[model samples]
Target: MARMISAPVLSQEKRERYDAFRQERTFNAYSVGNDTVMTRIRHKSLDCSPGCAVEATLQLIDGKWKGVILYHLLQGTLRFNAIRKRLPNITQRMLTTQLRELERDGFVLRTVYPEVPPKVEYSLTTRGQTLEPVIMALKAWGDEHTTFGHVPEICADMKGSPTNS
Candidate 1:
């Protein structure tokens, strides 16, 4: 049988207990003789209200560029410069940093090719691909509300129709 660990509730007693447990749990994970210590053990927790899935989701894809990068990757894999071209406003440094972060978070994969100049490509990993529906939903919402774009023909056709009314 498997045991399930439920999320702890955020309350005064819980916070105090957590704090006490954290303090009690701290120790020198590594030590050199009696004078020096290399590392200390610690347990970190996100002290947030209950049911904070939105916060968790935002932590994974909150930045201005991550979602955009993910959106572009949804089409297929692209080289570094190709992604950069899609988001012209992003600096090379920023793009590189965002890609690295995404790759670190298991949402993007970086593949390097053995070539003269060392070609590099970025694509969504399987975990990243799970975000497709989210990206699509966001795109659909943006398409409906953004001022710079017009409604799709299908939407336009239905706007004033009897069923819509």
Candidate 2:
């Protein structure tokens, strides 16, 4: 048998705050025994003034591996090992963590097949697909600005500029 716990009562002010917060953000709530836990799924904050919108967007894809993961997913669905192969530098644990976070935030869909060893596939969700332009723009920027083993043209031009002094 398992013991159950009841949710604590919130004060009137606290309740109002809770409601407001819920209105601004998306969350998934589940019960652990009898206690309810709210997990944040997205940070759609009501305050999108000035840099807040950019901040909220960044919060969604902030992890180092997230953008790269999404970029690959844009090509098509891939298995866990395939994704790992593309990101050779990432550890298995880190990849798992980033995938879970992306799934939690509605950016990735994880499908598991009941098989002898369990087959798992990950693909981007519709919400995740919406980031295609942003991701591609980032890729374009990197392609133009990144120089693998040589100085970038921009750096060479800056070397002789007044600011370089």
Candidate 3:
């Protein structure tokens, strides 16, 4: 059964604890600087909070661009510019940073093809694909309740788009 995890917005303490958990995982990730770390420590579970995994989920996906990124990826594999077109307000830097984070967190697979300039595209990894149902549910909730009907276009004009005209 899916673990029913309803965590609050990440508090500073939780973030600190999560960092500690990450450090612990890193330290415990290897055994005394050996090349076969996982071979030795393969069976042990890292020390984590009661709901650390769930907490990590909220932290990774609840940010401004994350949900949107995941949502568009649900539609299909999308190039960086396609994502930018969907979210005209996000700066190129911000989008780049978010994609990097998602890749780091194993939720996004960024494929860079060798081409004229560069051909880069992003899609949801299996782990990320698992999140579609949950994200869609959240989207449905927002669509039904948000005063603006939760349309991206409705919010698009809030700042009149981010690019310099």
For TM-score, the strongest prediction is 2
The candidate that wins on lDDT is: 2
Whole-structure CA lDDT of model 3: 0.75
The stretch of ten residues in a row with the least summed lDDT in candidate 3 is: 34-43
Off by over 4 Å in 3: 1-53, 149-165
Q: What Cα-based lDDT does every candidate model obtain?
A: 0.78, 0.82, 0.75
Candidate number that wins on lDDT, 1 or 2: 2
Q: For model 2, what is the error of residue 68's alpha carbon versus the real structure, in angstroms, after optimal superposition?
A: 0.3
Tell me the number of clashing residue pairs for each predicted model: 0, 0, 0
Give me the runs in candidate 1 sitting further than 4 Å from their true place: 1-50, 149-165
Candidate 1 C-alpha lDDT tens digits along 1-165? 999754334468755865664544234232333212222223244445554666577778978899999999999999999998777679999999999999999999999999999999998999999999999999999879885543454444435553453
TM-score of each: 0.61, 0.63, 0.60
- Candidate 1 local accuracy as lDDT? 0.78
Which TM-score value belongs to model 1?
A: 0.61
**Better model by TM-score, 2 or 3?**
2
